[model samples]
Target: MKHQSSEYVVVIGGGFSGLATAGLLAASGHRVTLLEMQDSLGGRAGRLHRDGFSFDTGPSWYLMPEVIEHWFKLMGTSTTVELDLVDLEVGYRTWFQGHPDPLDMTTGPGAVAAFESVQTGAGVALEKYLAYAETSYGLALEHFLYDGFSSVRSLLNPRLPALLPRLAPLLSRSLDSFVAQRFSDPRLRQILGYPAVFLGSSPKHTPALYHLMSHLDLTQGVKYPLGGFAKLVDAMAELCTKAGVKIVTGATAEGIDTVQTGRHTRVDSVRWSDSRGETHRLDASVVVGAADLHHIESRLLPRKLRSSSDAAWKRRDPGPSAVLICLGIRGKLPKLLHHNLLFTQDWDENFGRIRRGEPLDTETSIYVCMPSATDPGVAPAGHENLFMLIPAPTLPEWGTGGADGNGSEQVEAVADAALAQLAAWAGIPDLAERIVVRQTFGPGDFVNNVNAWRGGALGLAHTLGQSAFFRPANRSAKVEGLHYAGSSVRPGVGVPMCLISAEITAKAVNGIKDLGPFSMDGQNRDAREPEGDVQEERVAK
Candidate 1:
């Protein structure tokens, strides 16, 4: 294991994907510098601390443990050593409107019983659905998620044709219809279809291929890094530092300087501004745009060197924007769980409003997280930490937000409605009054802070048109020595996908086209080897 070539690599955006890309490149013997606009490294996976309460500003659920573990192992560490991960006993609690009680979802017999209680023979349907999901998950891990789609031959596996029949329907049909076909109960369908939100899509728009998300939560279960998602961010930042990455926070990337080398335009250096408005330049052999792809291309690079144009981006779905409400309540929320979902009875109408770019609906579905239930460190003693996520349209009409009710009318109104809903549904009528600290983050905040396209909270929606090989490539099609790694790019959204995206980007930078998971031995294996052989090696290890 030696340096492939000591190229200077500049990774823009200090999010999970950015940090992971910087660390992997550094580990592979590249001189790396990571630039983050925020004062902190974590982008969306940010932390908000106020009045002795700490809230994970973005992602909370820790699914896909293997993906997390794989990245840690690659960095010469283990999750057991680096992260104190707690396997949540109850994956999540769901409260459907009009239902008398909430369903606490776990795994095995309990999950079956919960579903069976809702609809006759629904328990059996769940088992069948999960079986398909587990198979799909395994297939994706083996053949799809890891591959960068560098070559058409990357998908020319002998096993693929055999699996195509089973996979075709999943790829073509909407997740909503797929779940509806299996179970007649709306609750069961919601449980199966709700994972679409994680992909920044509604079930109607998201392909059923994403049903594999169910396997990650239902079969494998959910885990939380002990201090909160911020701990995971801390771990990633630490790993990047240990791998010799120079992380510069509060440094905004102004533009990417390029050189026309022969027939290709290559990134020469990145022009950035510091917190004090000091301009600086860093020469690099390669640049990874780990931020929002739309921001990177439209703003940073010159139009001639841009891979995706304004017209191109318009055709793509920027995914759903969200309004995040963080609250520090005065007393314990007995009814709240670490993870909770409040589903509206009319799923079609709720999601339809979002798709049509309508205003936030009165009865929209919401996700609430009470991390204090699992981690005492998040909030002061006797108080509760609450976070509510409402998926809204990417429309600017919703506006931005601030601390202690200092937000635009539309944003605050959504928060107000969420609090009222929580009080009514969770039996906590005084939820609003008990809030000792209140903060709201909306679409405008996403655009202002992260340069999100159209204020989309997540990168791109995982629709049939924007998935897998159809998604944007990691390497720049127009510029040489330019790459991408993040939710906006390949494997899709979520912390785990971002980590995997880093590996894919690293492989492209290393000039290794092996469409399999990179070996932990720090060796670039032959690209010609079947991906199954690599899987076998991992298992044997």
Candidate 2:
């Protein structure tokens, strides 16, 4: 077979991690063939469009905007060209028990005050807890996350020795346990533990290191893209095309083929079924798997090497599969801000039922994203593109409340109920009547489109046992020329971490030097814009 020196690297799922891997590899002087099964590239960050209104699919919360921008600039474009990001003043509103007014946790001290309102010294306790979170977050970025840990020896580095003291605190304790120890009030505990679910796992199971979410949100701040996350994906897609990467949409990957002799193995190529149902094979020097870890392991790789029997592998990693309700409303919701979180009174019971695979509580928590409140471009004139999500488990256990094994129908009903609840919770006037166009994505929808294993919205649970070295490594242990990225792999979930994971994976594939994890702000400050930027010129179709 003829081979190209700048190998035709086939990137299997075109989510944030997959695209980032493809884009960086192409920019670094390698030819890349990106294969995405869906009609779109964003993966979990899916897009919905109707009557000139656009809505972001899954991940509505935009943190670390600079991570996307930095990669784009590296490939000759800035985020500004395709998406306008506005920093939120009130990051999120949490309605604690007994407090009539919800806690607007934009300011750090205000979050401290929420605890203070419950007890005299709770504010001081929170300050101390936040200080500890800050310390662990700094250590994690500097030592644990940035470097690729090829083996256990690599994790025992002397530089990371200082992190040893924190490892017990961060690794041994769950987010819920850590918060309960620090706060006497259950209300304060709920508010603090809420962000842990962003990992897609419940706070009781998620690691304490996830406390970084507080720093990432309340301190670093939350941002919203002008046209939602889809705009950001579109911007990156434009850059990839300009960089000469071959993006094949509507192409479903089948599996990989590898031949081995002694210690070395050659990945011959990848096979995929396109829209026409014709099987297409492309020879490649390298292959990167960007889809779900289980899909890549079971469907794509040879069966002998799969980890189906491993206890850790078989255990369900509960990521809250979101039921997104997108509405193209006839008019704007002036009372709603750019971002809002509507909390239910019995939040614990709600999560308990979800974890148990029962129906989500009638009064479940909801996240509302009103992009028109910030960018105005997402919705048509005098209209709004509203995205509301209720987090729930992907799988439905037997004999659960009204779920009846058909998760799609049950989840859709839950989405409708949640929307109705949201309108009442937030006091939105005539919200049900205002929606001119609407759609919903349930667990089955995520499974069919993204091929997310068991319809898991996020990858693995970010618990102490499943994070960092515990996560499936970027470099496959048994398979050569096969690598993993996306939510399941290292650096964990979210757009920033996904992009970072891709960068590190590409470096490992190319044998390039590791660049330590830098903050989104740090990257923008250090990296220079290319002259005559490609983003300035429209790509020749």
Candidate 3:
């Protein structure tokens, strides 16, 4: 709770992380200014409203409800209006090539019985597996993700040495390998491994430590914030304003001007342009570049002041982008549910083609979200709002049959073919014909709208070496008083991780020192508590 007072902190980007950072800083008695390039806020989590249809354009799955509750509580806001969280009875449905019926997944005691119903003895394994996953999840929030870490030295804490044995899986194994080793059924394996898609990496490439995500999915639960992600955006903006933070939208940040002292260089001010082509420079003592990490570093800051090298960035694995198609249908689609994941048997090949900058796979794996099924207000009466997404490479103009990889025209052709395939696979014979409102956002849209580096829909890829303390640090090593938060920074991608990143960076801004990556819990924990005591708390009632 300790903080630096009376400093003017300028936050670039009005996204979730930026809003959280600005609110935290202002609440700590600092003067904060948040500049967002877009006319409205929400960044990637932006909403689309047209002709009586509303859809969360980016993140649809609302996981980690605790993060939101904790954030609101910390900001001294009432959690009553936080979200009308609905616990999905059927979290999602997955369609496999030859499967007769779709797979229905849920959480808690019933979940154990359900898995056991599918495969003998598998339910017993699930119960035990989730218990293990819960332990990992607790260790994550309590030890590392919530705590501030500036350098590798954070890992040198005394507590970490005792925790090293448990951390070996994160260092040595992958999620897919872990699932394969645990479950025998391929259907169940896919169900367990699908959570990796949120991390924006292949299960084979994601670290095994991320299996805690399974605990979140299977044991904990998936939630939908009534009114979509935009509700959180509204609440966050309101919180920031209440905390006396200035929110400026449609203000595009062009550069971060610096002033060099004897040994360190400090961000002097930020130069930004409004929608009308008017440019202005605002002075600041601290700057939080939360827009896009790579975009800010490569374009906003001077080359000489950048701490990360282009070669180093290239060496790191980037997360998968997407080709998102939001269709407002004219008729009801009973074949789909709140969340549907359609996959071909060639799952690995699908990921391979997408990750390698090749065109989308012939048999693409698609995620179709029909929120209207759960919330009638999201669509017109007797109709469904279909949000379709294909995890794709962040390429220029590349489409299934686009010319030279940059034409939006080719994206339409790609969309048509994919829709036909989706209809056949999902057993919805008239899928394409139901569209009354259509919007296609490809990689080209990603770059133009949010300045996404390489059209990345997710943050940086959560590869082995690119994870944990190895990911980009929240605090800048070269620029004094400059910090970062969001999917691109440490703790990796996802809405929950971004919230944690905001907390970590906020604490750091308030003069909290990084206790290395594995120091004991900093918030509400006795500094003297030994790391050996780290364990999962009881499940929330």
lDDT for each candidate structure: 0.87, 0.73, 0.79
| Native-to-model Cα distance after best TM-score fit, residue 214 in candidate 1, in Å | 0.7
User: What does the lDDT come to for candidate 1?
Assistant: 0.87
Q: How well is each residue in 19-38 modelled by candidate 1, as lDDT tens digits?
A: 98998887876778899999
**What number of backbone clashes does candidate 2 have, counting pairs of residues 3 or more apart or in separate chains?**
0
Candidate 2 structure lDDT: 0.73
Show the lowest summed lDDT stretch of 10 residues, model 1. Answer: 532-541
Using TM-score as the measure, the top candidate is 1
Candidate closest to the true structure, highest lDDT: 1
Q: On a 0 to 1 TM-score scale, where does candidate 3 land against the true structure? A: 0.92
Show model 1 residue runs off by greater than 4 Å: 1-3, 520-541
Model 2, residue 298: distance off in Å is 0.7
Candidate 3 clashing pairs, residues 3+ apart or interchain: 154-516, 154-517, 155-517, 397-405, 397-406, 398-405
